[model samples]
Target chain A: MVPQEHPLEQLLRSDRMPHIWCPGCGLGTDLGCYLRALSGMDLDKVAFVSGIGCSGRAAGYVAVDSFHVTHGRGIPFAIGLKVANPELTVTVWGGDGDIFAIGGNHFIHAARRNIELNVICINNAIYGMTGGQVAPSTPLRAKTTTTPYGNYEHPFNFSYMAAASGATYVARWTTAHTKELTKSMREALEWKGFSFIEVISMCPTTFGRRNGFADGLEMLKDMKARSEVKNFPDLEDTDIGEKIVVGKFVEKEKRSYLEEVKQWR
Target chain B: MSMKSWQNQRGFLFLKEERCKGCGFCIDLCPKKVLRQSEVMNAKGYHPPELYDVEGCIMCDICTEICPDFAIYRYRSKERGKNA
Candidate 1:
């Protein structure tokens, strides 16, 4: 019963109305923004690639030409797609464990090379599909299947890592705020250099149940209330690395790797 | 195809059911009242949105935009026009 003029009217599959994601999970909001971004841009020449995990299945949900790649190899496949077809707008999709953990090396090197591709990292903090195990992004002291006694390790700040690794575009947002997430995704897709969007998702069934949250919606509300916009005036020494800043962290015009390769002629 | 013309003729939307608590968030959000509660239940036993009239649906997918669960999709065909 949706109207045809709405931006998101075309990308969905009616037969697949009810998705497989758990109730109160944040993946829906993240997916909605991602699709809105895709719909807003020119996608006739776009190709989506995904790695193993719940986020990996994103390719199958949308209407774009998608490639389901091997576990921890989505970015590499997207890189190859861009290299072979420079005109194609390639986007890589994966989870925190797949990108920032198991495929951590590839993630850094890709940014270091300034690969001209969009990487959507869905950070749920824990490995949802693999039985709620603690991920590299799992906060310290957070309980998980592997860390039932509480994790002693610190979680990785994905946007910071991308910025430090030479990516041309880096941004962070949570699923609770869809408008900002969609806006950032749209910009990242238009960037000519490597673009990374880190989305803090909710694995309610696992992360919530283990962390003592009543449900995923509670976690989402917490994330919404706890996140702050990054502003220069808001900077405080004590706030450094203590508060989560959500916004466009970095974006600049740079020589894209694919463009540089083409110029070699 | 001209970029502007192609864009004008083609459109799409996505529905994310994971966020849906099946509380009918989009059902109340749509201005046109295009969406309705479905009798069929999904694997999760939540009744998803069901389109009452396919032709009446203008492909607005506003249902998707306002849905708290992110459940509702719309798509328009470029090569085939708006028939199917």
Candidate 2:
């Protein structure tokens, strides 16, 4: 028998049930947080754009005006959408690899330009969609399909990078911190000019199993134990290692790209 | 309280067993310890969670918050002023 629609069904493409995400993958949780963040807001005014990855699939599931853009192109698409229709709330959602690897240049330049865009980067620390490859955000000594022996390179601290690149708002949260993540998402949506939120998610099928966590739950518990909520800290101290520092790292007012363009006219 | 009496409570928890992938996030995060992993596997070969102690559930909705698959959620009765 078909079950009754869930309360959050209105915000979801219900026909896309049983999403392709694995049993314990945190992308679903992240999507839930994003939807919860959109609660009480004007859903019609929202345009969600996502790049190719596990996180990118969220565009298909969300019952909003959404676009499943090409790899590492979510930000550019969002930028175009926002510029064309400044009234719409534009958000770019994609994985760490999509945002920080192939899209890394776009990410920083958008932040540098202080564009009026909400960017949600789901950091699973690996390229989960394309078979667990070593990503720019992959932590050192972590095993991925490509980094079989262990990742020896340092990873980018996304919150710090966002702040450094001139994002008006920046925050970091893990999947286990649902309430905080939801709050951050809401705040990011409300903020203008390159709001970047780095969500530390788990890919049990790839990053988690390749590392040590047996599944998503174990990874979440580990995150819970290692996470410390501090309002702000030095960018150098924001590295993800044995302990992860999570919180609102930066929130400032600035002239957004749209506003600046209007002034130039 | 009796099972029948508990059924009159303002809040109820539902588990869409068929949709559950048995990740156990709901069970692990339930503050009241009201759920458990059922031995019975669903069509997906996953052990869907079951309510073990409904009386303890205060309808905090933590399970709903933590469920990655959206397979679990809480429903509050429209009857006003009753304990949730």
Candidate 3:
């Protein structure tokens, strides 16, 4: 009877009822969407790969076949999985530091090659797992353990980076936009080329407590209020100061990296 | 007066039908039996969950807590004087 339940729901350990995420953490919602999407898909055809970090925990929670890959190496692992079994739907999950910092080169090339894999970047704006360290996504002047005085470095616009780097499908959605995030994820799964979705979730215990967000709910509500929904080009530079712009910024079809490589073969 | 009157309060919980994948997490988790699967398919054709007894709400807020998507919200009834 339990087996008849939605595969993803059944896959989860209800006994593990209380989740590890802090209350109001968006990662749980992202996991929910991932489970829902995977429920509608063929379970036998799915494989998830993730690098080290809080975001990497997703691979463990998911019931599907998944890889807990090394730090900053999730993308390559997923690429290898897909290349070996083109029929499998592979997904890579990682934090901003692991993927965009240490694994930066692989990330760019993965996009350039257009590997047909779904990449979910959980951009919490700080290195959450090890402590609230400064990350590539930490906004200018935001405080972190490494930058207690406030970080002066400009953060990477992950969506624009992926879009410009030749990823066929690119989008950004905050944890607050659950519906849009879920929709974008579903769309990303259906895409034949490289798909990237940057999810802005909150790290309550570390980022929130340290940065005065108080709790996860406060962070989620604050982000919901501050995030502006807009087209990429229509977004004004001035608005970036008031709040972060969030939405499905890009979705286009291009020659997939897998197909391009096949051409040489 | 009728069954409708017994279910007239209409809580703040509303499912964005196009977004709900009919995973039934909401249905399985509602503490007050307020939500049920709708017979009419929504815009996305998924049988999104719906409220069964709007007037029967004790406003426990458990559904909102269990919801991973944060898709549900509990609002204060205007007649309740003190909002929850």
Candidate 4:
């Protein structure tokens, strides 16, 4: 007898199963949420873009018109896609290192210009793909390969940064908050202007081991315990540290870059 | 709440054992506490989650939602099965 296909099989490239993501890594959960968010939508018009990193591989796994771009270039590539065909739903998925480190300039500019694209920043706090190195989103005093002593650098509060930089939609959630993350993705997809969703993910093999978590499940439990959901909290108070503020921090109507370009045309 | 528990409820939970990485996300987040890691190891050497008690399962699908590996899923029967 033929086995039944998984409900999410259609959205995923089944041949790519046994994905490269390490066991207990939160990328799979984030990817699942994203796929679920797009499941009932017009997938034909959806485009997934990613940059070099563990999260970059997401583009290949998703059964959509996808682009696996260069390191730190996912946002620009997605922006170009949006500009070329304003009808398509363009989303840039990448790790915090790819999105906030090398491609940070593009990230800020796109948000400042209010580009019509969805940006899913999977923040595992370390450069998971290139070995566990320090990342822009790495918390203070966290141990990484580069930060053997401890990460002294202050991490970027992505939710606050996006809001301050002019993103019309800004939100943050941990992988443990599956239902909320999926719902936030759906809402971000519907939003017209630049939308940013920072999903704090687990890198069990690398970050978790280095940071003292027993495994991925322990890391998730820590996230679940530390995260406090507050809708529209003050931007200044949203900094990453001991307690992570996770929720829809900002959502407001704004004319997208494409809308302004159309007006100019 | 007690009255709702009195009705004969039926639900099904399936685990694609090979696909699971034994992350424990499902067991941790399962609202009904119906899942627990089994002693048996799969091909990957991870103890995949097993259904422990089905009595309080509301078919919430929390396990499916929290599972990173897409290894577990659940469904509820339209008609309640005969009470054991």
Candidate 4 chain A: worst 10 consecutive residues by lDDT? A1-10
DockQ, model 4, C-alpha based: 0.37
- lDDT by residue (A1-265, candidate 2, tens digit) is 3224566878988778778999999999899999999989998999999999899899999998999999999999898999999999998999998999999999999999999899999999988878989999999999988879998999988888889899989999999999999999999898878899999989999888878889999999999999999997787898999999999999988999999999988
- Candidate with the greatest TM-score versus the true structure: 2
Error (Å) of candidate 4 at residue A133 is 0.7
Order of quality (lDDT) = 2, 4, 1, 3
> TM-score of the B chain in model 2?
0.79
Tell me the whole-model lDDT of each prediction, alpha carbons only: 0.73, 0.87, 0.72, 0.86
Better of 2 and 4 by lDDT: 2
Off by over 4 Å in 2: A1-4, B1-8, B78-84
Model 3 misplaced regions, further than 4 Å: A1-8, A13-17, A232-240, B1-84
lDDT of 3 by residue, A1-265 (tens): 1112222446565444335555446677778766656667887898889899878877777778979989999988888899899999998888898899899889999998888999999888888879889888887888889898988998887877887788888777787676688788888888899999888888887788777876666777788788888755542342234577877666676888778878999
The TM-score obtained by chain A of candidate 1 when compared with the true chain A: 0.92
lDDT of 1: 0.73
Model 2 CA lDDT for position A243? 93
Candidate 4, which segments miss by more than 4 Å at Cα?
Answer: A1-3, B1-9, B54-56, B79-84
TM of each candidate vs. truth: 0.78, 0.94, 0.75, 0.92
Positional deviation of A63 in candidate 4, in angstroms?
Answer: 1.2
lDDT of 3: 0.72
Candidate 1 lDDT by residue in tens digits, A1-265? 4343435537755345455777667776687787878875676898888888888877777778888888888888888888888889999888998888878889899998898889999988899998998888888889999998999987777877787788988888877667888899999888889999888777878898888887765777677777887722221221213356787788867787777777887
